[model samples]
Target chain A: MDIKLQKVTKIFQAKDKSETVAVNALDVVIPSGKLIGLLGPSGCGKSTTLYMIAGLLEPNEGRIFFGDEDVTDLPPEERGIGLVFQNYALYPHMTVRQNIMFPLENIKVPKQEALSRAQEMADLVGIGELMDRKPKQLSGGQQQRVAIARALVKQPRVLLLDEPLSNLDARLRLQTREEIKRIQRETGITTVFVTHDQEEAMSISDQIVLMDFGVKQQVGEPQFVYDKPINLFVAKFLGTPPINLFAGEIVKNKLLLADGKKYRTETQAPEHQEDLTEDAIRAMTHEVKVPICNVEIMDKKAPDGDVVIGIRPEGFVVDEKGPLELEIFMVETIGRDTSLVVKDPFDDNKSYRIIIDSSYRVKAGDKVKFSFKPDKMFVFDKTSGDVL
Target chain B: MLEKQSNVKAWLYLAPAMLLLSVFTFYPLFNAFFLAFLRDYEFLLGSARGFTFLGNFINVINKPDFGIAMKNTAVITFVSVPIAVIVALMISVALNSIKKFQGFLQTVFFLPYVTNAIAIGMAFAFIFHSDYGLLNTMLGWVGIDPINWINLRQAGNADTSWIRAMFALLVYTIWGGLAFKIMVFLSGLQSIDKQYYDAARIDATPKRRVFSKITVPLLSPMIAYITITSFIGAFKAYRTIIGMFGESLRPPGALSKDSLITIVGLVYDSLAHADATGAISEAAAASIILFLIILAFTLIQMQVSKRRVHF
Candidate 1:
């Protein structure tokens, strides 16, 4: 089923009499027959948004539509939505067969038909042999499969999963994630999946809506969103080990580091040239030529502004002659890649992380020179945190 | 050396409790069984009296009131237990659906279970009185004449009979008996994972189907527990009845005594007037019979319930 949320907001009355906006003015369109992921940090509104769509929660101000019908005020049952909780929420007292058949029996399907359908769902989820066993009698993965089968038996128009694989072990998470993707593809049902894990969301979703602090940061296809994040939060949140940022100032129409390094901008100069007269521009330009000046204009080759520059861990390259010197503080070798925690002599409050091939011999207290590709450098406005 | 010391320490830790159990529980149990064959003074004075095999047992079986008391106990157990279990289950299901003030309602239902039985019996006596009672007053408003209820023996002599009205007192007893059972079933209902209901709703399952297919089957274990406990409790339903009808209704008498006399009341009558030795022995025999009946019912219920329990 297609889902549409218009001006959705959720405000929770906290214990201390404060209102916490869990979702704020969110508008989203989820097309039918596709898997969509709501991804964000722990306190973000991803799960809240999914719950609103599932009819498990009512948005404070919004209208929800499933297909052509407005179902905002409908109960969960009336909405015809299947929801799987994070804990799997299987009834421990019922056998797997009974659990799967519960929805059919509730709908008053004939006993024989309910049995056959239950068996079909069981086999589909690959837990047919365990049908007679209760939830506790099965492994976590098997119980998860039974929960999925129970949700599917109703043949609901929309399926909602809230961090369905978060309870599983690492290996099982990957396996189950793959199974979820395959099942979603096979069934071709509209599904909204919620998770704080970006990789899990990116791997399975046709479209990913990334959120932060109850606000929609960005929404796009997984690859497009990853490659071209619209803002600093999106850029930093989507990557592992996060992106590194540096403070630079605008000087002489060029970017300047605090440590007397100058960088040039490839983009057009600011349109506020009228604010800076010709004489002021000339004076600013002449200051770059003076070597003894205390002002450190960023290198003419770098992007220019008083901006925070974001560099991915993989963006840095090891160069013996590079100008940037980082004191390696720690190194974590993980077979294929090594994560290095290095101190930035230029900034006391922050550290820069760089990733290198694991084969490279690197250790703590070692000094390393690094350079990043020009295009890989992302500059953001310091105050707005918007990409500049 | 440390392992041996720990083992010794474990035994030392358990010694006090073990000693208490032996002194209070196990020793008394063995003494009761042994004394079952001896004269009363042998038990009281710890004398070495010769065993009178089946002597007391044979005398107890020959008592005329034994048959009537046994029948009364059976009737109470069979009728009261099933009714209490069914009523408790229904109340539990209703309480489960009430989202608001559920705890308050549960506490109200559970209050009677914790209240003293004598107090409930006193309260019930007033309400079930033949005249100037709440029930009779309500019946009067419905154009029914006031009739003798507690004094059913007198009622039978008059133009009207009130045996059925007297039996209505069982409903009060059942109400007080079912409070704890309802709490147990309520907990069982709450323990059910809500996902089952959600799944049922998605399938458009009707309310009745959901109750039968999911709620009833899932609550079988709790229902079984309630059944066994209620059955045991019903056989011991003497205090309330006596408190309501008073001692006159169960006068000191032989086996051809009043129809309302129960096994415990008979034992009380015999001990108060007849030979105390014979009365104690007869009480023991009656207790044994009651125990066996409860044990049989419990065993049967367990067998049937075990088949239905999902776990």
Candidate 2:
């Protein structure tokens, strides 16, 4: 079922009577039968949001709905949600079969039927033959599957996973995450996955909700949000080796990079240009001394002031005649892609990571000219961290 | 080579404790076993009139009060242990769940453990003292006549008086037993992972089902431990009774014999009259019987609780 949160907020009162907001007035529609990832750094309220959805936590204000039903006051047992905690939370004393059948015992399902349903869930999670084994007797990955099987045995409408694979080793984490995805797909449960790992969220989720502090930042398809970030924070959070940032300015109608004591105009748009065609900007510019990105990607009428420029590591292409020049601080080559640790001469000698093809034979201290891929570059208002 | 060196060093570290145990604990234990078989033994005179298997046991068991002591000990053990275990389990569970005043309440329940058992028994004796006692005064307020709880020793209403005396002893013993059992149970409850309850709650389990299926099973090991220990403790109860009924080991006034005397009481009474032929041997024999009884019951308890315990 589609889960809906309308201005849900949760505030925790510590022992000393100090109140801290864990989740703010957040709004999101988790589409039915699709996996949604609540992605953020630690203490960013993603897990809090999942817990509220699972009915394990009550929002101090606002309502939660499962499909059409307002379940704000309902207890967790009535919510029909399968929540798997980060630790797996398997009953240590019970065998896999007993743990799975335990939930059915609450609803008074016939003993024979409960046992069969438990077996079915165990089979679905691929722990069928291991039902007789206790939780500790199984490996971490197997135990994780058992937790999932037990959660599924109740046939809950929504599946909530709180960093479910964090307990497993690296290899097992990969394998178990695939198992979770497969199980969720086969069952078609509306699963809400919470994780601090951006790659883990982006790799599996149909839609990813990025959050910071207690507020929602952006929510979209993983790649769409990565490629077309709405703001500076989104641009930096959703990349590996992180997005490269440099301080620059938009002087008059021209976006210029501070090249030491001179303003090197990358591209120029008409004062009120709505559609900034790259050809039009190039035609109006003086003789092209260096290769640079088209300024058309910037929002129209972007105010002329200091701005933060964010570029993905993959956004750079080494060209001898490129507009931006940087000294290579270090060269780190790992087979397919070589990451050049470069120092931007324009932005206070800040270090930046730009992934280039390993085929380049550049070494440290060599100055390399680089050009930007238009879509991969973003301009943001410096103080407010908003996209310009 | 490294392991051998560590092994010798470990033995050296354990030497003082081992020496103490051999002198005080192990020597007495073996000596008792040897004396129980002797026809007549006297530790003071260092004499034994040769060995005769079961002679001392048979002579001791033939005494009329020996059966009574056995009956009294059995009554106390069987009645007090299960009641104390259940009550302490409930109290500890309550103590574990409450958010506020937990430490204060735990200290209150645990007060009896720190106080000497005999002191608590004396206090209970005064409460059950028939006239001008706290119990009788409360009973008076409830429109009941003062009952002879521990004062029937000088009287002739034998069966009723004995039952009342037994009741008083059970009450005193149960109160003294609560503190340790509650402390053990409270610690056990604390160590249990709380997530299990959360899982049960999400399953929409009823409170009763949660207690029976989740809470109790998880506490089964502790319950078993408390059960076996309380049983042994209740079996070896003598000092508390002395505090209540005094050196006579009976109720007040009309005592023709030491009523409510436990097996340990019988053993001590026999040892006091060590001048009698075979009396010291019989005391050793009585203790051996008590040991056998405890061992047998413990083994049975271990077997019964074995299947249920999670660990």
Candidate 3:
């Protein structure tokens, strides 16, 4: 089912007559049969949004629709949603088979049919051999599979998972997530998965909704949001070895990097840097006396003012003749790539990172010159964090 | 050597609790078990004639008062404990469902637990007092004649008086002891994760079905605990009746020791008449019998719980 929340808000009233707005005027449409990820930090209202959709919590302000049918006033049972909690929440007293069959029994399915359907769900989750075991006797991963089978046995229209993989060990987290994706596909149930792990969300979700402090920050394909974030928060939140930020400004038609060097915006076409001459590239290896050029185009949309520069670690190329220089402080090699932790040459108070192919023989104490890919760089207005 | 030293340190740390338990709990238990087999107990000399295997048990078993006490105790246990458990469980479920003034309701229900049992029994006796009592007065308002609740001697026959006294005692016992059971069940119900109920609600399970299938089974451990303790507690019912009626037991002119005497009351009566030849022996035997009955019920409950309890 396609779930829609229109101007929804939830407020929690505390004992002292104070009120907290947990979710504020949130609106989103989750299309049917697609796995959407609600990604955020701990207090970001992602789980709150999922619970509202499940009808566990009634919105204080607006209506909720499940495939064009208003279900705001309905209870959870009438909404036909299946929710798996962070702890799995299996009935400890019931065996795997009984736990899976409980919902069927609730709806008064015949005894024999309920048993067979429960067995079928167990087999689907690959726990057919462990149906007789209670939840306490099973490993964390097995327990998770039982929880999933229990939620899916009734074939709910929308499946909700709240940090389902948070309780598993590292290896099991990976394995169970893959299993969840497969099960969701096989069942073709619309799923809303809430998690704080960006990698987990990015790996499994068809669409990722990033939120912070009860507000939706960005929503798009995981890679698209990563590559082109709407704001500085989105840019900083979605990547590993997170995008490096620096205080920057535009003055006299020159982009002034935090490191004091100034580059004329019209010196070279940013699109043609890959084909630069070898000597030109090698010339970038020289000292502070030589200045670098043709790095990237300053976003024309940005008003002339103070801005924040965002450079992904991968955007930096180790060209000896490139425009920017840094004093390498440390080198870390991890198989395919090497990380160069360097002192910012122009700004004494800051440091930057450049991840180069492991084949590069850079060492600490070496002064390296570099430049960024034009496509990989972003500029945000200092006050508003809007990408320019 | 380190393990030996640590073991010695552990024992040294445990010395006070062990001393207290041995002096207060274990010694009395063993002494009672030994005294239960004595033939003639002389309280003046603080000695017994000889160890007579099951002699005291046989003597106490043959006494008419002992029989009446055993029957009365059984009646109270079998009647009041179940009523208390069912009523308290229902109250706990109702209290747990409402959020407004929940703390106030809990405090009101739990007031009886901390209040003196004897005080509450005295208050209950006034309410059930027969003439001008609150209960009889309210019934009189509805055109019903005042009923004799306590001291039912005016009812005329032995069987009718016994039945009336039993009914009056049961009402007080069930009412006086409900608070503790309600508190236990309420805490048990609260400890259960709200997620399961949320899951049950999503499954569209009916309220009665949820109670039977989820709440009951999930709370079976607490239920078993409450059952065994309530039965044992009811078996030891001495104070409530003493508070309601009196130590003399029968009213101004009673015929025999037939009114409302519990096992503990019988034991107390025997100990009070300690100058009699076999009085101490009979008291010890009665104590032993009460212990055995409680043990038997506890064991039966544990067996049932092992089969049905979830955790």
Candidate 4:
């Protein structure tokens, strides 16, 4: 079922009577019959949003609808949602079969039918052989399956998982995440899972909702969100090696990069030098020079100011006659891609990385000239950090 | 070689405890077993006429007070242990589930445990007093005639006195022991993973079933522990009755060994008459019997716990 949250807000009162807004006023529409991932770092309110949807937490200021039915005042038991906790939360005293059958027993489903349905769910989760084993006797992956079977046996409309794969070993985490995806497809339930692992969300979710400080940053298909980020935070958050940022600016109508001492300028305009307060020059450090025509600014009208440039590690292209030049200090192989750890010509303190084809004969101590792919680079306003 | 040296070091660390136990616990216990078999033993003279096969045991067993003590101990252990345990479990679970004033309520319930049991028992005596006490005055308010709870001999016949005194003793015993059991069960309840309850809530499990199927089973280990220890504690029910009925340990005006004389009380009585022939030996015999009874009960509890407790 599609779930809708409108202007939902949650506040927690601390022991000293101070109030902290855990989930600020937010609106989101989760489409039906697809797996959506809520992705964020710790304390980002993703889990809080999930609990509010499950009715375990009451939104301090708004309404929730499961499809067209308002369920804001309903208790968790009334909402047709199956929630799996991070620890798997299986009843340790019960065997796998009993754990899977507990929900049915509560709803007063017939004993024989409950038994068959539990067995079917266990089989669906590839744990049919572990029915009689207690949760403690099984491995974490097996216990997770039992918890899922227990959740699905009652046939809830929505399945919510909170970092379900976090407790598993790396190899098991990969295997079980795939297993979860397969089960979601087989059941076709509208699922929402919370995770801080960007790769996990990108690999499995049909749509990813990225959040920060209890506010939604962006929401779209994972690949779309990755290729076209809305801000610097989204760009930096979604990549593994992280997007490289440089203190650069736009001059006239072309892009100028901070390449070295040759480009260092008295950035504060002489006319504005008397007003160079800390707030005005807050993160502005200018070493901009060498305009090139190949790069494109996101918003033409917003160009011509000290700005930041975000370049994906793969955006660099080696050319003998390009504008950007850097001295490579190290070259390391990452499967088919080679990482060139080059010294940032503009800032000696930063270790700049450029990923290139491993087949290229790039070595340490090579001075390389590079050009940018306009689409792979982003220009963000220096003060507000928004894409320009 | 290093392991051997560590073993010696471990023994050195244990030496003081061993010496203390030998003086205060082990030696007395051994002497009790030694005295129980000797016939015609005298405490003051430190002499025995001769050793006889189960002579002291036969003498203690043949006493009129012995059978009464055994019956009284059985009644207190069986009646009070289950009531105390179940009541304590309910109180602890209720205490745990409330959000507000939980710490204050826990401190209130735990007050009796820290207070001396004898002091609490004396307080209970006043509460259950027949006249000019809080209980009888409350009964007067309820329009029910005040029942002579402690001094039962002033109110009824032999069987009636026995019944009334037993009722009073059971109440005092259950109340006196509840604080410790409740404290234990409360900590046990707190240690349970809250995720289990959340999962239960999501599953639409009714609160009653959640208590029976989840809370109770998860708490079985603590229940078993409390049951075993409480069984041992109830079997040693002496001071609670003394505090309620005073040092005489029976209803006022009742004949000797008639009502509320526990096994420990009977043992103390036998030990008091040390000038009499075979008195200390009989005391040793009575204690040995109480020890065997507690041992048998604890062994049975462990066996049951092995099969039932989840942990």
Q: Best by TM-score, which number?
A: 4
- Candidate 1 lDDT over residue span A131-193, tens digit each: 899899888888889888888887989988989889999999999999888888888889899
Q: All models, DockQ values? A: 0.35, 0.52, 0.63, 0.82
Q: Which ten-residue region of model 4 chain A has the weakest summed lDDT?
A: A290-299
Instruction: For candidate 3, state the interface root-mean-square deviation in angstroms to 1 decimal.
Output: 0.9
lDDT of 1 by residue, B183-224 (tens): 889999999988667656655778888788778888888887
Runs in model 1 deviating more than 4 A are A14-17, A257-306, A320-323, A333-335, A344-350, A357-363, B1-24, B39-53, B152-162, B248-258, B273-277
**Residues A318-361 of candidate 3: C-alpha lDDT, one tens digit per residue:** 88776667678999899889988876654567677779999889
lDDT (tens digit, per residue) of candidate 4 on B207-246: 9999999999999999999999999988988988888777
Best by DockQ: 4
On DockQ, the stronger of 1 and 4 is 4
Tell me the interface RMSD of every candidate, in Å: 2.6, 1.1, 0.9, 0.5
Instruction: Tell me the TM-score of each prediction against the true structure.
Output: 0.85, 0.91, 0.91, 0.94
lDDT for each residue of candidate 2 in A149-231, tens digit (9 for 90 to 100): 88888899989898987888999878877887888899999999999889889988999999998899999999999999989
Report the lDDT tens digits of candidate 3 across residue range B1-311. Answer: 99999999999999999999999999988888887887787878878778899898888888778877888899999999999999999999999999999999999999988988788877877887766579889999899988766644355543335666678778888888889999999999999999889888888889998899889999989998898899999999999878777886643234456557888988898899989987888888889989898999889888888998987
**Whole-model Cα lDDT per candidate?**
0.76, 0.86, 0.84, 0.87
Clashing pairs in 4: A299-A388
Worst 10 residues of 3 chain B by lDDT: B151-160
